[model samples]
Target: MTIEPRQLPAAQRTLPAMLQRQAAEFGQRPLLRVAGRSWSHADAAAAAAIRAGALAQCGVTRGDRVALMSGNRIEFVEAFLGAGWLGAVAVPVNTASMGPQLEYFLANSEARLLVIEADLLQRLHTADLARTALQTIWVIGEATGSWQPPEGIRLVPWPAGAEAIAPAAVQPGDPLAILYTSGTTGPAKGVVCPHAQYFWWGVNSAEVLGVGADDVLCTTLPLFHINALNTFSQAALTGAEVVFESRFSASGFWPSMRASGATVVYLLGAMVPILLAQPEGPGEREHRVRTGLGPGVPAAAGQAFFARTGVRLLEGYGSTETNFAIATAPDSPRGGVMGWLRPGFQARVADADDAELPAGEAGELLLRADEPYAFASGYFNMPEKTVEAWRNLWFHTGDRVLREADGAFRFVDRIKDAIRRRGENISSFEVEQVLLSHPAVAACAVYPVGSELAEDEVMAALVARDGSVIEPAELMRFCESRLPYFAVPRYVDLLDDLPRTENGKVQKYKLRERGVSAATWDRGPGAPRAKG
Candidate 1:
């Protein structure tokens, strides 16, 4: 049976309403499986309703934004759906955030309540939360821990077994989540994702992957990423089950899949290479995994994975601002190409003036979904920036891509001044600002240096003050305390001056060309190089 997502026509109303319908239709079928535990559709819906009731007791109101910070635990899903059931916006915070970054998220999101894991409570101190509209803190684990709350912020443990409440009526266009993506400038901007957006994403992905009731998706992606959230949405749409893990470990990847009986999986940047590095053992290819999704798999790596595991790796391209626009089929034409545009979506390769380029011409990729709210509405609290990117009526994907005469699209490079490392989109501007904050750093420019592992690594090229002697290790320590581990630079280059245009704009392109020169201070973990 194909378990059509629309089995309960009433589900079209809202996200919470959809889960209720799924519970009624699917009954005891497993919905979320993590480690040794499992929650059926009915169990999850009932739990969410009761959780929503508890939140209401905590003074949660409709349209309120609740910030969630946790790993890939079942509690994260419970809190997310619970917030939605109350018609409140759920804000998923990146767990990897440090003090300054976390502070910015809490203040910028204007979330009154924050739900976080007890272990992560240590990162919550600082006056930023005190100055914000935030008032309450809900801890997910042991409450008797030594962690302290901010001034004026009331701390409480997650309430137990509140009675189920009626789900608030939700519309398709209602603001579902305010997902924060790194901005080209300033702090991370929240992207307004509506209920309809996720619905289409779930359904379309289900269709592309040929998912059905019998399938089990093994997802190690963190809940902070849209990719992980979609696992639940897609499974709910079909009658499939998802086995969740806190994070991906190449050593434990196959073992977990085998134990969970997972038929499907997802990957991110550099995961293919890591998995390939592991020595093959007996029953490696015996797992039931039939298909996997995500981009950034090299042609040779893809072939290697397929030849060894007998499972097809399908590559697709998209971002938080845009859903999956381009994807390769199970039997795509070539090895390195991200296949043609998916149905109902229009994409064009355009030059600076939005003039459409011919096939095989590499340029910026602009996409517009035929359906409304299928993509994000705009950046939250940044109308001017929204208008800037959505100029001429199309969302400008800062990616450089090429389209073949046969409609196959190949990803070329990114035109934006952003960096993608370890599946995390980082703002080069934000990173440079952080480095510039160091008093010893007179001038700084951050850029991407290609990583043999996969995506680009953060590399900083800076000019120290005339009398300052900045140490690479010390600089990294400062960044480690302020930025997320992934956003911190892996390579540092101290220079007397940086290449700049006649107009005083730092020519980062030239720095990108002079990546990791002999004079460049290489700090990455490997064989030592001279700092000449």
Candidate 2:
């Protein structure tokens, strides 16, 4: 049977309200499972209530910021749901974040508390807690014997369930989470996702995937990203079951699905090629999964994957600042496009000046939602950036695409200076900052180079300081501690000077055109030695 479409009232759009409604409707049906732990629909709401009470006992109140840095586990979900149930905003940090990025997220959001995995506590050693508003840290597991808390910061074990508290009287327009998206020319901006926006995320995604009560949804994507977090909402609204694996393993992916009896799965574009690269086996087609949301899978790879595995991966388009506004149905008219715009949203291909371009013209994609609070409220703590992105009463996607005569949006290229590698958006500016900090580096430029997979790879060009020689391998080792693993440059070129304009601004486009060269240093995958 299919889930019926219903227009939920504004009050029901919030997480607290949704949990109650879902519990009453689905009752004891399995709603969430992670690491062998299961929670039924009623248990989900019950868990959130007790978790909220625990947060309230810690002095958290409405509008407080609670930061969470963890992987796909039940505690992460509890903290997220608890924050919303307490009318507090949740800031989910990417688990790959290192000291510098972690410091920025806490400082920018002014989070009063942090819920982090015990292993990630060492990352805090490099972060200056004095610069942030963090007062307490709740570690999810036992810390190392020698580990010590920073001065003035209270350290405690994972919170226990307290007295069950009533759901907060939150409104639909209230902020639920502040998710940070990588910047093109600057630092990352926190997108203020509202309660209503997540409500729509569940409704739209469930409809696109045709999720039902009997369906079992599984996702290996990290919980910190919206792609995985939205899976919970999809199960709640559609009366489905969702399974979360600790992490994605190409070898173990099929086995996990078979064990869980997953009917629906989630995947990224890069994952498709990797999964296909594995030696063919019966395991590929041994699972019950019929379809998945593969947003960035290449047209050729998608067809090949389906031919081998019998699982059709649907392509879709969405960002941290927007909802699932564009999608391809099971019977979409064509391939190689981002799909048609979904209902409740409007799209336009516009030139640099925001003027709309006619059909078949390549331009920036602009979008706006018709439903109230259906899009992100704005960039938290960045008013000017928010205004710049939301100018002309539309959200400028900073992505260049062509609108075909058939109303299909084809991906062209990114207009912004960002790199997406391994399903993570990397900011070139952030990488350059780390490179410049090295004493041997005088000038640097970071840009994207096309990878064998249908995605971008981080590449850097640098000029050495006078009388100081820069070692490429050593520089990469330095970056390992400062930036995320995916953000580290795979290829590095040493140059006397970079291509620049009349005003001395580096011309990254020229470097991008240059691409990988013979003189570049290469870090082969699993290679014992670096190649140049």
Worst 10 residues of 2 by lDDT: 523-532
Q: Which lDDT value does model 1 have at 326?
A: 82
At residue 296, candidate 1 shows an lDDT of 83
Query: What are the RMSDs of all candidates, in order?
Result: 3.3, 2.4
Where does model 2 exceed 4 Å of error? 1-6, 526-532
- Compared with the true structure, all predictions reach lDDT values of 0.83, 0.91
Which residue pairs show backbone clashes in model 1?
A: none
Put down candidate 1 lDDT per residue, 46-127, tens digits, no spaces.
9889989988998889988899998888788899999888898889998877777778787877888899888877776533
Tell me how many residue pairs clash in candidate 2: 0
Q: Candidate 1 lDDT (Cα, whole model)?
A: 0.83
